[model samples]
Target: MAAKTYSAQHFVECDQCEENPAQYFCKNCPGQLCKECKTEHKNRKITKNHEITELNTKNEAFFGPLFCTDHKTKQIQCFCVHCKIPLCTECIIESHNGHAIQKLTKAYKEIQDDLQKKKEKIEEDLLPKYAMLLKTENLKQSDFSKQAQEIEKEIKAHTRQLVRIVKQVGKNATEDFQAKLHKGLQRIVDSEVEIQRKIEKLKQTKDLLSAKIETKPTVSSFEPVNERLLDEFEKLPVLPKYHFSKFQPGKIESMIEKNFGKLPILKIDTAKPNEGDSDIDSQEEEVEEEESDSEVPYNLRLVQESRRF
Candidate 1:
């Protein structure tokens, strides 16, 4: 039933009682109080001096108005430009006498306008750019992964091809080595057979001379036979010479490059974009301009910043 007392707005429960619709706002305690709790709150020694006002009349408190801390009866009418604080009539006569003053309403309007413009800039300009950037980055990441997979497949295929080529090369080299070895061995074997035949012939001649000497043969006959054997021995063909196959190793690095091709190096671009082209910097500059032009006080700045989240 107490909610009917409030204007056309959401009903709020008293901060103290939590059961009744709030009808009053305590400036000093900064609490919402219902009509029933307001009397008790005022009776309390700690809250008795607090400035309490009807909720409907306290609308300006939610905006940018404040009662002076020095003179509790007077509302802030001016802003001390130098100190960047809300000023009451008493504040102007005291410490802020010579300080640059601006109307509190003007300052509040300027802060509100600046905040609105920043909000519009974020929504219209920065948010869309960031969203597009996010999309592009996601696509780029996917593309990079796809390209890497493709390159990996190619590398694997090349490696298999190189393996097959190397196997064939090794097989061919082995076959060639075997052929040359056989040829060298065959030459040595042929020379051995020829030398063995000549040895047998020389043995037969030696036996015949021994038998003729045993029968007391003349010296003239033996001399001719011995001379012939000596001539045959001297004329015997020199052992056939052969050079065997030997393997000469090549450079491994050169072989790898020649067979499989050089592996690609990983390159990364870590260089940042131009400062002027940076969106973050541009947004920061805009925020700085908003702060400078509005000359928002600390509390108002806090309020503006809280709205961003």
Candidate 2:
């Protein structure tokens, strides 16, 4: 082989002699080696398989570290799996003795493959799937809010209708009660007027009897007035008793409450897609129809009591 050339500025001294300019760089010894030193390095049993690159083939600045830190004259050729560190031949025999070790190239290839697999999984599967899941959850949240609002509106409308009905019922019941009360009161007033007339007649007859006695009028006239007074007194009218019927408002409230209780469990039929239909548009249409079909009817009856005053 032709003698290797060395650049003046890029020249490295041989690690063994520290005299001649280095011609070969040993990746295992990780040090510069002159021609003489290279011969000696190859002869050594531990460094026989060490990779050596010609320094003259490329720029010296691009070359990586050729010598081990702990073993100054040795190169990092092996990796210690246990400690996860690079080692020279001497390091392997000394500190990393009996540990699981492999060539740096072999460890590099294996670790590179593992990292590539992880990157592919993240880019192709994990990240996309997670993003889709996030989108679905957001849509579900929006749907939930929308459905809740719609149900609330329906509830308010139903409640207003119920309130109107209750109010009308109450007004009608009040008017009916008032009419009955008025009729009862008028009958009582008429009885009172008749009693008053009889009292006045009795008073007049008594006064005539007194006048006859004082004047010493004829006995026949006084006797007749006394008899008429006794008859009017005996025939006095008795007053009739009256009372208002009890109106229970709580029964109406209870009926409303019972109907309202069913609101939570009221079944709204949802449209289901046929098993044979696989079209996405069909599925969406079915969902929309089901949503539109969902209806909760307020089934309530007015509670009223019947009583006579």
Candidate 3:
């Protein structure tokens, strides 16, 4: 049997190829290549100048499922700069045609760059405005609380004043009623004493005659008089029922409204966009779908605004 000699090339791995066709990940390649295949692949004019490194996608996070502007059925694998419409490579010749289109990864990075700048602007300007709004809300709440306290105190004082008036009127009526009651009692006592004295004298005179004598009541003793005096002293009125219905806090009412008016609404003002704001608007940017490559794409998505009432 003859001994076979093995070549060094057999042991060495292939160095150049495409990383993934699904991702359109031509990491500088025309077909699928592992980390070893990167060196031996045919270096094209465009890809020779392009950068390739170890799969360090840990930093490069992504979001997708983008749509093709022209085909509508084709998913957006790439973005055309001049046309500003995303398209798949199959539509690149038919839809994008001759226009320059870059991979969606590059486009995403461009968006990220704008996003980073916008984040800084939000920290410096936009976030502070939110903080200011919170502070304004707090101040308004404090003012409202103060107004509520004042109103409460004023109402208490008003109640006390009305009560005092009722008490004063009741005291005067009670004093008059007491004076009339005392006079009525004294008149009744004097009449009882006069009747006793008269009866004693009649009995003494009748005993001396020793004859049968019929006693007759005198008309003067039961004379009708002063019925109005007894009616006046009856003192039967619901004294506290009458009260001041209209409470006046007229001065304090204005202050209460003033406190409530501290809260203001959002006004219409032209805010200048930061350097990357146009890019944020672009993310919301719409691409028109057409029948073929001949038509122009028109954007129609309007940015929504948030309003505070």
Question: Model 1: residues >4 Å from true position, as ranges?
Answer: 1-65, 70-74, 164-254, 269-309
Give one digit per residue, the lDDT tens place, for model 2 in 144-221. 345444544544444455565554444443443445444544654564556455445544543443343222111121
What's model 2's lDDT at 227? 21
* Tens digits of lDDT, candidate 3, 25-143: 23333232444434433265555554444332222212233445456676557667775555676778775688887766565455444444444444454345434433433553455
Local accuracy of candidate 1 as per-residue lDDT tens digits, 1-309: 344344543356689977767778887777788898999999999889988887752255432235676788887776777776777888899888999987654554544444444445445644454344344445544554454455445445444443444434443334434454444445445645555555555556544434443221111211222223334544324332223212333333455323333222222222122332343433211001123566665323433443444
Residue 87 accuracy (lDDT) in model 3:
63
Q: Give the local distance difference test score of model 2.
A: 0.48
Query: Which residue pairs in candidate 2 have backbone atoms (N, alpha carbon, C) closer than 3 angstroms, thus clashing?
Result: 28-75, 29-74, 29-75, 30-66, 30-67
lDDT (C-alpha) at residue 8 in model 2:
39
Off by over 4 Å in 2: 1-63, 66-74, 81-84, 98-100, 164-254, 263-309
Model 2, residue 281: distance off in Å is 26
Give all TM-scores, in the order shown.
0.40, 0.36, 0.30
In angstroms, the error of model 2 at 22 is 25
Decide which is better by TM-score, 2 or 3.
2
